[model samples]
Target: MMILDQFYAENFGKVYRSCGNCGTQFKRIVQINDLWAVNGDVVAGINTNFGDTATIRTTQVDGVDDICVKYTGNSNGAEPVEIGSGPDTKNCLYSTSDIKQL
Candidate 1:
């Protein structure tokens, strides 16, 4: 008799984003092809249509795992940011940082 088995792994990361317009914090999930290197050896990337903000921070999920993206931002005025999965579609996730007034 013979048997077959399969295994899988769950990969996740964190992508940080700060609003250049209102200092709002945002985050999104990093896809497989939406990844880039930043600051030499630091994995960085951004979700273009993440939200109303223009710029954002992207980082690896873990020190080893290079999947998913986590966002960290202020919590004062910080609120959930919209991450667009497609045209006219988006998901909401709260920032992991506190907001500061400038």
Candidate 2:
């Protein structure tokens, strides 16, 4: 399955995967297995239907660069929606989205 977006936190041993086409989103976690475990001392898995768990090897995956932008704010407003060139201007990328100010 193709993964559309993924988020990971270092040392958390957790991975979040989101697929747009299949409408499937799930998280995988890795942990140490108890003595009764059969496969190995450490196990990584994700749950499927019927409460079944499938063992998997989790790895850090990185892809294309993401658009990381910082939004600034002011007491009145953060950014101006329109630009100026004799009234010929476009809105900033962050102008359309709803954002909160502190």
TM-score of each: 0.20, 0.16
Q: Among these predicted structures, which one has the highest TM-score? A: 1
lDDT of model 1 at residue 74? 40
Runs of candidate 2 exceeding 4 Å displacement: 1-4, 16-44, 47-102
> Which residue pairs collide in model 2, if any?
none
lDDT of 2 by residue, 1-102 (tens): 223222232332223211112333343222211111121211122222212222222222233121111112122433322111110011111111211111
Q: Candidate 1's residue-wise lDDT over 1-102, tens digit each?
A: 111112111232333333323454454342222223322211222344443222112222223322212233344555434333211223222222211111
Model 2 steric clash total: 0
